[model samples]
Target: MNARRGPAWTNSITSTVRRVLAPLAGSGRGIFGTAALLLLLIASGYIGWAKWGDIIVRRPQYVLTADCIEITPQPPWIHSDIKSAVMRDGSLAELSVLDPDLTKRVVQAFELNPWVAEALSAVKRAGKTAPRVTVQLRYREPVIMVRTRDPRWKGDCFWPVDTEGVFLPPEEFSSTQTKAFLRVEAGNSLPAGAVGTSYGDAGVTGAALVAAALKPVWSSMGLEWIIVRQELPNDVGQPMEPTYILLPAGAPVDAVAARRSGRLVSLADPPADEPSLEVRWGHAPGREAPGEASAAEKVARLHQYVAANGRLDQLPPTTVVDLRPGAAGTAVATGRPAQTR
Candidate 1:
């Protein structure tokens, strides 16, 4: 009787356990099915995107044309030609295809151009049917014209150089652009025609500095030209040094005279054949010789002398004003009658 009672009790325990597990098994199956469906959907989307990605990139709605590009500080010359080149250079392949890396390449291409000093940015507008590509460009501005002797040319050739001594293409310049700048003669013998290249020569660089420094006073002072001549070594072991000369525009040397009283006398109507006064600007700005004043100091001294006296032409002709530091005084205007005052 006790064994029969134990079997009945075991059967009752098994039935209770089955009833508790049935619902849990069904829930597990449902969860597994949901996970499989999610994975399938993800795989299908990826496959579709991979197959149709190029199609989306090539869509007409996303294509960029010349009209879509914008340049800042609009250059004096036509920009449509440059826009065409940009488009041809794969800059406007497709809005979708232009990743960050490709966009950088496009910007570099524009920067490398001779016309552009800097390519600040290239951006594509998002969510637009006709996508626009905005390009920020800094154009190369010519500060001074350099007249150098090129072996390839029979005569002296002129090159438009920026303040950093970078050569710009002469063909790109219009007459108005060419005539507006002052000319620097550095006796640079380097070959020309390679636009966007710099001589990196010290003399050329110094000349550029002088030109930049004088720009403010150039027109005001009636200055016409700057001549940079490299002097021979003083001693056998010494290096060569540069000398700067400032020539007046249309004013002749003999037109202004130093009277016996040491006062400046300007001729009422000077002859056109008379030579212009030449100011001896000791050296270029940054390349001052040892024991010499800086270009800024020299310029200041020259201005002080001019203001104390009068216009540059008011000084005597053939006058050599030594502006170097420690030079006898602020300026020693030699080759002229001594000032009484």
Candidate 2:
């Protein structure tokens, strides 16, 4: 070993050259490395194509944007509806696949109704490449329905409740508009939507009882704005402050009264704290109370007493003929005109 130290640097260079050229000299392993890399690249491409191949089929789907939200009472033409508003726009046609935007346009129009409380629109697609779309609409119910005298409605009556029976939104009308609709029918003159529902009329009911039932409704309409409507319009509100109409003694006497009030108070009334219908009624003009009596009996007696003694014309500001007991609805008595019932 001590004798070999003289040529150490030259030997080290010779050893490095042999090691560096060893693979090129005769090893076949380099070809195996190239093959491994080629296989890796091929595997990656196959896996990627397998996972994402269906993306092209899903790309062309339809969508709907409406009212920026969902709505109710969807129109008949629209596919989405809350309750009865939902309907099928297709009628044995593959139209959605041919044209998606057309379906969206029709539904949009239905959503535009002022009565609609809310509206939602979206596109629905079917099939792989060419998708078909469908639409939907919702609507608002405006009138209150009551018993009808018609044969078709059977025995059920409708109450004029909104689609949800909640009050309508204030934005639907002007500040000056105050309208209340109450309907009872035995005929087919008005549409079901206008009156709140489609129902048959009740035939041959008593007159006074019907009047009593409708009395509350009529009173409510007149007092809606806390304004006095002398009379309802001939078709709506028209006359002075709200008035209590005298019935013509018919089956729907209360209805007639209601109609008159609606016409008289066509516009919102002036502010008033006390409700007009709640005003007190007094006993007829004269005849002192002989003794204690029940409310019903007292009313009957007062009618007799006024017929015999009191001259109603003699009373002041006695617009109504109060036949109610304890003079509950009697007008003021004046010393003049001779009180005759």
Candidate 3:
């Protein structure tokens, strides 16, 4: 029968042991030789454990606590501590750094935050002093504030929503912060749904798209509200269809300066005497009438007009500047004072 071969290192150790103990056994000290050999093995094991046992053994120090999870910095609009919120809400206050699925669990936890549109990735950064997991995420930003005619919402109050009409936390914005966003007046609609959910109103959704498109130049255009009108009172013989109107601020104040200085041109303030200026934005993008100009074309035309007239409000008040294909920039006098609400 062939002798079973052990590892080379083990065989070498066995040979060394036999050579060292052979003298004691031959000297009639066999019991002492065995005891000394056992002591040597135990001492070697203790030294080995002291040198490298931490790497082999798991401990609480090696685990990931909530404080060890780092999130990428969020935008100014994000007021809540996303890391704390996610960890507490997800019940992931403690996680094992050695867990094979650590990164996956981290991603899932961050996704639980309503403001987090997507948790892109989580990477475990193994630091000698302390380990940490860094997470990259995409956040949903509020594009516009929508005001429905719902009686439940008091006085000029609005709900902030993203481009897709996803409602954002209202308390996140102070009264001063709200002035930074454009407003959409979705007349005759209900209140917005729960926070972080879609507002679920078609008019509000369409109005949101228009608001987003107008956001860049809204103040420059001296605009205050994007009104979603189902029908125009002036269109007596025409069929009723959804249309958008850009209502410029009543006063001829410096729109750009007002916005930059954090001042709002109050609709009911001293500008009460001036007639309202309305840019008749015919339809929201992609829903234009067959013969009407495309949204891009309309915006270009409006910009051209603004370039020449200084701003949309440069036109006489009580005037409606049509931006559709056929009636482009033809101002119609409404012959009425601006309504203050």
Clashes of each: 2, 71, 0
Return the TM-score for candidate 1, rounded to 2 decimals.
0.67
Per-residue lDDT tens digits of candidate 1, residues 1-341?
A: 56544444345544654565466557777776566556655665566557765676667755556676766745664333666665676555544433445457668767767667788888867535565667888776667776666568886566777777787778766646655676666656453447777855555666677778777776666565666665556657575655666666554322322111121122332423344566656667766667877777777777777766666656665555566655545765655446724
Which of the two, 2 or 3, has more lDDT? Answer: 3
| Decoy 2 TM-score against native | 0.26
Estimate, for each residue in 279-336, the C-alpha lDDT of model 2 and write its tens digit: 1121112221333233344334435534554433223322233232343343322222
Error of 1 at 290 (Å): 3.2
**Residues 1-341, model 3: lDDT tens digits:** 99999655556666777787778778887778889889867765576557655554356776667778878898999998888888788877566677678889989988867798889999988776567898999998887787544456566677888877788888888878887877776654554567768887766777777777777888887777776666533446664456776777654323322222322222333322434566667677778778777777777777876665656555567455567764554332232333310
Off by over 4 Å in 2: 1-93, 97-138, 151-156, 159-189, 192-341
Please give the CA lDDT of all the candidate structures. 0.61, 0.34, 0.69
lDDT of 1 at 207: 69
Q: Rank the candidates by lDDT, best first.
A: 3, 1, 2
When 1 and 2 are scored with TM-score, the better candidate is 1
Q: What is the C-alpha RMSD of each candidate to the true structure, in Å?
A: 14.9, 21.9, 12.5
RMSD from true fold, candidate 1? 14.9
